[model samples]
Target: MTLDIGTQHRDASVSGPSSDLSPSPPSSPGLVSTHAAAVSPAPARKPTTASNAASTSAILSWSDEKVKSCSSLRARKDLRRNLEVDVLQNIQKALRTSPNPFFNDPGAAAQEALRQAQIYKAWIQDQEGSSLEVAIVNDHPQGPADGCPPYDFVWVNGYVHDDTIPPSDPSELQGCDCEDDACNPATCKCFQKAVRFDTLNIYKESKQFAYNADGTLQDMMVPTYPIFECNSKCGCSSACTNRVVQKGRRVEIEFFKHQHYGWGVRARHRIKRHTFIGIYSGELVSDAEADRRAIVYEDVGSTYHFTIDPHPIKLETMRKRLASSPEGRTMTEEQLMQRVNDWTRLMDLYQAHREHKVTAKQLKEFNDRQIVEAKRKGEWSRRWQAELEAELAEWEARYREEPDNYLSLEPEDQARAEDLSLFYEDQQEANELTVDGALHGNFTRFFNHSCDPNLATWPVWIEEGSIWRPFFCFFALRNIEAGDELNFSYTSAEEVDDMVKRLNQIQVEQGTKPGTKRMKCLCGASNCRGFVFG
Candidate 1:
C-alpha cells in the first residue's frame, strides 16, 4: 500500500532563525538499492530546484519592515551540547541505560525538559553559523508557549546510522551501466527495479518515474510504488531525471510557532506538485529503543517516531533463512546403495528418519507394508543405518572444518532443501528501525497535522544494495502556496505510516470509540477525524 497537521491564522511574517537556515551537507557519494527479486545487488542518486515563488495575499501584514526578532534567546552551545551530547552520554553510561530515558513521572520530565530547553536556546544562538536549516519564527505573545520542549531538535537532514541494522558493504553493490553516460528509462536497472511493484510496460497504471520532464511529480504517482532513485554507483550523471528526494530540500521551509498547535513548518515559496520537500530524519534506533521511547512520549502531542518496516517478508528472505537452517540438508540412496544393496529402496527413508532430516510428512508417505518389509530385514537395516550415521558425521565434521565448501548442499540434497524452504518463513522485525525526531531533527518534524494534507510520505532507497533499509521521504501531494503551513496526515488508511486505520477498525468491530484521552487534532478541516489516535 502507498504510505500516505493544523492551525490558526493572522501572522505578520516574522524572522527568527531564518539567517541560520542553511543547506545541509551532502551525503557521501557511492551510498544507495537495487531489484527486489535479487536478495543482494546494487545502489541509486539526484539534485533539485524549488523556487520560493512570491507569497499570495492582499494584506501588507505578510511583509516585514521592522527588524524581525525573537524574544526567546538562541540555545547556548556549551551548556546545551553538554546536556544532549556529553552529559546525556555520561548519564547513559553511568546508569547503563539505553538511548531513551524513562522518567515515569510527567511532572519531573516536564521540569527537566525546561532546564534543557534553556541551554538549547543559547546553544542555537551561539552556533548561528552551525550547519542547520529551517527558520524558527516565534510570534507568540509569551516567548515560546508551546512544545513539550519548545524547540524541535538539533537539525539532522539525513539519517544517522550506527551498528544496529545489517551493514551495507560497498563491494557487494551493483550499479547501472547506462549507455552514453546517461540512464535510459527503458533500460536503466535502477528504474527497472519498480517492475516488481508496477511498470510502464504493463500499461494498466503508469508506474514510470514519478517526475515529469520538468522535474515536478506526475499527479498519478500520489499513491504509487516505492521510489528507487539513480545513485552515485550508477554510470548516470547527477542530472539523472529519476533523482528527486536525493536532491535534498527543493523548497524553502521553516518552523513557525503556532499558538494552538505548537511549532509547525510552512512553505517559504510556491511548491509545485510532487516537489521533494524534506526527510523525516533522526537517530536510527533499534525496535527496542523505539518501543521504550514510545511509552515515554505518552504526554507529547506528536511522537516524532517513524518505524521502517515497510518491506514485507519476501520469498528470498525465507529462502535464504531456510538454506541456512540446520535441517535443510539430506542424503540420497544412490550414494549409500553400497550398504543397502540387499535392502529395499526404503533404506533411504530409514536413513533420513535416523538423521531426523527434512519434514515428517515425507516419511509418512511410506506405505505400512514397505516399512514392515524394511524392518523384517532388521540386520541389514542396522548396517545401512550405521553407514548413514558415519557418513553424516563425516560430512558434519567437514562442514564444520570448511564452512565455505559446505555453503550449499550436494546436488542429491537439492530436492529435500526445496521442501524445507516451503515449510520455513521468517519475520523481518530484526531489520526494523525507528527514527526519533523529537529532540534533534530537520524541519520536516515540525510539519503540523492535517486530515487533507498537501504532503505524503513514502519509502525511498538511495543506498544501493540496501533496499531493506529505506529512507523515509516526504513528497508534495499537490501544489502548495508559499507561506502555507506544511501538513501531512498522521495516520493513513493504507498500511503506510501509522496504524490508526487498523486500530479504528478494531474499535468498530469491538464497538468502542477512540480512547477518550487521545491527542486532539487542530487541523480544523471539515472532515477532520477528531483525534490523533495513531
Candidate 2:
C-alpha cells in the first residue's frame, strides 16, 4: 500500500498522470512517513480501486505515528548521554589544571618576592640558606657587615654556638611515655615539670598548655613559661601538637634594611598568634662572655645580647608562703582596684616625664618613694630590696668610670648600665639569660625594639643527647598583617617608661635635639617614645 507523506502545495498547476488508487494526501502538512508495506506485512491481494485507498491510508497514518514516536525517544536518550560525557570531561580538566589547595601557591610566593624586591631595591632570595623561605634585602652600602652571613638555616638540638663545632656529649632531659600523637599534660612527665610565673615573679603556677586556647597571651600576665616539648625519647610521634616550635618557621619573613636602623625584619605575610616564627640563633656564650661582648658592642652603639633566663627567681620560703596564703590565690575587689590605680598613676607619671612635665630627678624621687611604700606594705621582700641596692651601687661605680660614654650611649643602652642606677639597679637585671646575636646570628638579630611590639620571644629548651639548652624563639604577639615590620619590647614596660623619661630629661638638660644623644625613634606608633632605645 502506498503512502503520501510529502507536502501537497508544490507546483499545483503542473500536469501529472493520476492513478486510480493515488495515495491519499497526508492528513497534516509537512508530515513525511515510510511506506506502510515496508513497516508492516504486505496485503494478501492488491486492490486497485479508489474505495480501498481510504482504508490503506488510515493504516499507513497509524504506522507513520508509531515510527516518529520511536525516533524522538531515541534522539532524547542520545542527547542526555552526550551532556553527561561533556560534564565529566570538564571536571577532569579542572582537576588537572587547578593547584593543590593543601600546599602554598608558587605563583603567590613569586609575586610576594617580586613585591619585596621592588620595595627594598634589592634581590629577594628564596629558601637558599634556610628550610623556610627568608627574603633578605640589604641596601645599606656603608656598614662593615652589609650582607647577611652565608649560613643555611640550622636546627640546633641545643644552644647555637659561634662556630660550627657541635657540643661534645650533651646531656638530654629524660622524656615521658605518651602513646597518643600528642602528650597529655596529666600524664606527660615532661609537661609535669614545666614552670610558669607572672611577670613580676609575684604569682606563680604550672600550666599544661604553653599558650591560651585562642593562642593569645594568657590573661594571667604570666609572661614566661619553661617550654618542654616531646623529644626523641618520648613515645609520641612527630605529629604531636606539642611539636610546634621544633618544627621551624612555616611563614614567609623578610630581612630588609631600614634608614635609621641598620637592618630590620618584617613579616611577608599575615602571621597568626602563637605561630612559630624563628629562633634567635647566635653564639651561645657564658655570662662573662656575653658581658664582654656587650661592652665591645657598646662602641658600635648597639647590643644583640638577649637574656635566656625564663624568669627571675623567687625564694623558696616566699613562694611557699605566697602559695599558702588565700589572698595570693585571688585578689579582693578593693585590692584589685588599688593595684589598678597604682599602675595607672605610674603610667601617668611616665607619660608626664615623656612630655617634659617632670624632671628625671623628680621622677626618680617619686619612684623611689613608691618602692619604699611597696617595701613597707610587704609588696617587696627585704632580701630583694637589698639585692637591688647592691646592684645599684655596682652600676654607679661603672658609670663613674665612663661618665662620658654613658652620656653618649643610647637611652636604652644607657639603661643597660648607665646613670639610671635607680631604674637598672640589679646587676642580674641587666644580665639575665641573654641570647647574644652580636657576632654570629640569624636574621632575628635585625628585629628592632618597639615599645608596642608585634612579636614576643619565648625560651624553648630542647633535650640534647645529655643536656637541655635554650633556644630563643619569637612568635607573633597578635594578628600581624603582611609587610608589617616585626618588633618586640626589648625592655619591660616600666623600664621603657624610665628610659623615655631619662632620655627626655637628658635632652632638656643638654639643650640638644631629641635624638642627639640616642637614635631617634621613627617607629611612628601613636605612643612612640621619641627614642628607639626604649
Q: Which candidate wins on TM-score?
A: 1
Using all chains and alpha carbons, the TM-scores for the candidates as numbered come to: 0.54, 0.48
Question: Whole-model Cα lDDT per candidate?
Answer: 0.44, 0.41
Runs of candidate 2 exceeding 4 Å displacement: 1-131, 137-158, 162-172, 195-207, 211-222, 312-434, 464-468, 499-517
Residue-wise C-alpha lDDT for candidate 2, range 410-505, written one tens digit per residue = 566444332222332243333223344443344565566665778776665555322224466777777898888887665456744654554455
Report the C-alpha displacement of residue 135, candidate 2, in angstroms: 2.8
Query: lDDT per residue, candidate 1, 1-534, as tens digits?
Result: 111110001111011122332122223211101011111111110000011111112121100111001001112233332234334223323222222234334343333333333344334433333333334443432211211123324444565543344455677456678854446767777776654434223312564675676667666664434677777788887777777777666565555555565556788678887777777765565545544543334223234566554432232243344345463334232222222221222223334433344233543464433332232111111222223223333333323232232124455554444343233212434454556555445567667667678888777777545555566778888889978888877556342223354444546766865332334556777877665432
> Which candidate has the top score in lDDT?
1
Query: RMSD to the native, candidate 1?
Result: 21.4
